[model samples]
Target: MSDVAEPAPSLARLGYSERWKALFAPMADDDFVPGRVMRIDRGIATVGTGAAVVAAEPAAHLVKTTGIGSRFAVGDWVALAMPETHERAIIEAILPRTSAFVRRQPGERETGQVVAANTDTIFIVQALAPRGPNLRRLERELVIAWDGGATPVVVLTKADLVSAADADAMREAVGAIAHGVDIQVVSGHTGQNISALRSYAEDDATIALFGASGVGKSTLVNRLVGADVQATREIRDSDGRGRHATVVREMIFLPDSGVIIDTPGMRALALWDADDGVSAAFPDIEEFAHACQFRDCTHTAEPGCAVLAAAETGELTDERLDSYQRLRKELEVSSARQNDKLRAEKKREDKIFSKAARRYWQSHPGQGGRD
Candidate 1:
């Protein structure tokens, strides 16, 4: 590592702390500058330093890194190297993340994509307009949020379109799935609970807004920031479905409050290594799982299954128990797939190394025997 000083004061203004400073100390390089990634598009990233926001590009080494999780993501603190040949600074290294929101990469691959890094809270926004919030999706979102090492807070948006009674009912439904997490109800149109929502965006805290389109994530961000930083569009009147407004993931800093990372509406959020997250998200199921007859009981068809017994005796609802089993099975399958991928990768590497050794032996036949 090249010798460099601690992060500048400008970084402190953007949520830099002593923890990050200590992590950066060993990786510091004199030739590189430090900055936080605010936006990334088409292999280019917009990084915000205390002085100015600059566009940066990942270096060749960073590009060769395999999984999207290994690459630069919004909220990542990076070390930038200014090369004379290119106009954009090269992101040479990414600082260790305290927490990262990740989901399984789209398609058949077992890899994952890191959505955001170093996040303190994940605002799981769900609209309460056309229909009540999807508790199943909320449960899944909570799993990923907990898996990412960030606190999960459910935010029910579009309450203005629905009556207060309907909003309260929806909140109760969500509370069933949310467990101990805080649930906030807010309306961008009526400005209801906007102050309470703003309270989470305290100074130096990083919060990421995640939800489907038309969930009022952008509107909420605009309200909290006291400016229309993110563009908002009207949803389709017929279905109340919203268009993909925030197409990119971007970090917006609030002058008075903290920072907010806005992400586009996700079509799907598949699980990836969310075992602990599932247990944390479904504490009731985990609590019963401890009393299972067998340590590896599946709970579906097992003797002395406390989880199944709870469901049969009216202690737990069938829907909730089904959701728990479904998510648990998904996690098990994902773990198996990931293990297979790792073994395949190891075999490929061994084959490559073996071939290289054979070629070296042929080139230096006399010396190969001695060494």
Candidate 2:
């Protein structure tokens, strides 16, 4: 729901499966109509309700009770209420999300921003043209993807820009850090390896494409969906930076295949409650830490630190260790900030409740009022 608008298709066409059907069964006989959020723009959401896609206005009460993170997102299954007086349908409720790609909301707000929800696979797209792949960014991407409970596959796009030998070398370099994750090299221009990427889109599955701007994410989505469904713009030739061509997050259904959710290029992918993701992204480093002499080793200058020792003996790269430590510390700091924010909000709520209760008692003396 970050930006843009799109026409709705059916819920089944949007990759609604048995899992979603079962999850929605609880509200079967209710007046609510089930739909999947295809896109949301300017407080209005485009939802596909099994029968047809339509624009729906989110109910104010739904937004208030669920908070921001629980708000409607692309790929979310929602209950809709249609009124005769209104042109747009009303989003009454959002079903439980099986998975979500979330990040820390920017600028001093200690909260999570769910970019996309209910995704089964996340394509960590990194371009090979703009000075090859950024290993550090890839690590960050993997951490969030793992944290979001989605299987991540590294998609090395712009393969046409590099020679076959160079491509292989870059793949190996990326493989060193990616660990168990799959890596695929494809070119939107040449149409190479595009078919191989179809495996994730099979059987009503939902895939999310994530990367920085100008990484050919939109172009790749066009190829996957076999149409120019998303707009494409050229990256700046001088700096290799891409403009935000796809300014919004959207879900597009591929004919005879599964569905894909294309999101705007993320400029800042800060971690938000991604401890499990960090561990999953850097399993090797965690394994080494188990053998450290100190139980609370910071892995910086601690003596008998197995991680640092491994780095010294050339078993592990110092850069990779540093990335791990940096991300781990970031998570710790973010968690503390979030906890503080929650405490403050709770305190404010308690104060307001106490004030309201005192006023009620004062006004109703017959109801055992203390005043």
Candidate 3:
């Protein structure tokens, strides 16, 4: 059974535009049709090629390619082979993405996992339930969202569980760290402010909901689409934490509007290639650094560090500065690891080429290089 329960939407409805047309025009293969990847199940992907949604597998190039890490994510527009058998569609290529929400693959050193692709906006869904959303985790989510090149909106869910005053207080706390991001509080129980979320998806934009488990992202998806597209599980307290987690990253086509991508609740969103993300997430810190005497001041115990001065005077919270410093250090460590990996790869490649060259020269007598 296909995970895409709704009828396959047209390519335009799937957020195809002139950009897609330009990309598809150069493809010499006339048998290929553009399609948006709806979901990936097992080794097969459910792709919506305007005509219909069909299960397809990636062609050898997409699978064997070295650099393209986790090539397909929901919201990616791909070139699908038009074969005689409708079920035999092959994903020949993945079009360049406008933005991708990526994080370090869990337990992997430097590999990145794409959570969503070609996303326009990301809702950093945080729960305002019995225990308020983890402020630290919310900040980290915002960093990844901004790093992905999509607009981040801090969405506080489960507002019904809290008093109106408490909800407002949580929103303000989020606003303090979220900087330029917009914040919205929606309660599924009261059906309050749910309609407003739809506006973010207007103009054929693709919005993805991202947060930790039990944030009500599944329930929010069903509500925003005005249907039971995503099955919601009861909030389980078996482990002292309520969770209604989605199984996989799935795309939901909103009726007469845009697309909404609901992703599996992530337990840990590790940082991956997120230098600009930290800068974007901590704009207030960046602003303060401009007035520092030394350009490379670490903002810790530096005599002329404006950031430290702000914290001392309560212009900036000590916690906020600490978060910025920690993320910056984390990004630096990730960068060093990636550099080492790349250098090792280059060294291995050179060794292989040298062996190949030696064999070629030995076979060709005086020939030392390819002509």
Candidate 4:
């Protein structure tokens, strides 16, 4: 294997097409250049301009950043201020994204972190562990991916560990829940179906990887890239859980075509603004709701509620309906909390403005006679 991976793709090949060209054309200020965010680490961003992937900091105004969720994501197209000297470039502006994979900040109400932006497709990588894929978790991931406006494909890794029959059984289970989506079972180590994963990103498309820790995202990334760009660890023998290997979300330019954003496994994936995603992911439930007696049926015990009827009659599995209800209820509670946060912020701002206004009027008592 080559110690060095292939060089990064050109800006155009990095999905910097005419749309980006038009967006950056307006801000054609001297010394300002277009760049894509490769990765962000410790207050510094690795931005890949056409020329080079340089260490960059956000323009002073954009700096008060916290984590990956607060600022530029892995796939953001940005405008950078590159000076003549050896100083790091400045990310002046983040161009509008075609799609954004946003999740609620874990343990925080009313805050969102965009996992990746402008991804044409998102590979929901779930390892086929000895216990099998977690159906409920897969459902939640589908909701977020559907809501993010990216084509979601389920890639089950570690096929070599399980028998063919077991892998087939697991794939069928996943297929049942992952309705209307492409599903692939592959061994990243053995290179089984790796080419199929590559086919999704043809013609300079961008793909984002999302999954929980110990799912072999890092191993798959290294295999897909055909280089040891990311680290890998073995799963625990006792509990069958793999250790976390990837730390920062990094973007790599594929030698074959397009770019891939490899992200660290998430411990928690709370929903942000995924109401539409819920409907999209659960089309069958939505279809049943449309035929219900009342428009706002919660699918619980509502009389003539088609969803409940379906669940009772074995048309829809009880477990699946429960998952759907849980997600809906979670979204409802999250939405309320987010609204409350927004209201409190507005009130605080208003109080501050009122105090400033009162002080100005008191200080300039005679000068306030505009009438």
Candidate 2 clashes: the total is: 0
* Deviating ranges (above 4 Å) for candidate 3: 1-6, 68-70, 85-87, 238-244, 301-303, 353-371
Clashing pairs in 1: none
Ten residues in sequence with the least summed lDDT for candidate 4: 1-10
User: Could you give candidate 2's per-residue lDDT for residues 1-371 as a string of tens digits?
Assistant: 21124444656677777887888787777777888888878767888886666788888887676455458889889988877677888888889888888888776457788889988999999999869998889999999999989999999999998999999999999999998999999999888999988888888889999998888998998898788888988645657664688887888887787888998889898998899999899889889999999998889999999999999998999889889989999999998887898899899999999999998988888897674
Instruction: For model 2, give the 10-residue run with minimal summed lDDT.
Output: 1-10
Off by over 4 Å in 2: 1-8, 66-69, 292-305, 347-371
Clashes of each: 0, 0, 0, 0
What is the TM-score (0 to 1) of candidate 1? 0.90
Estimate TM-scores for all models: 0.90, 0.89, 0.90, 0.89
What TM-score does model 4 achieve against the real structure? 0.89
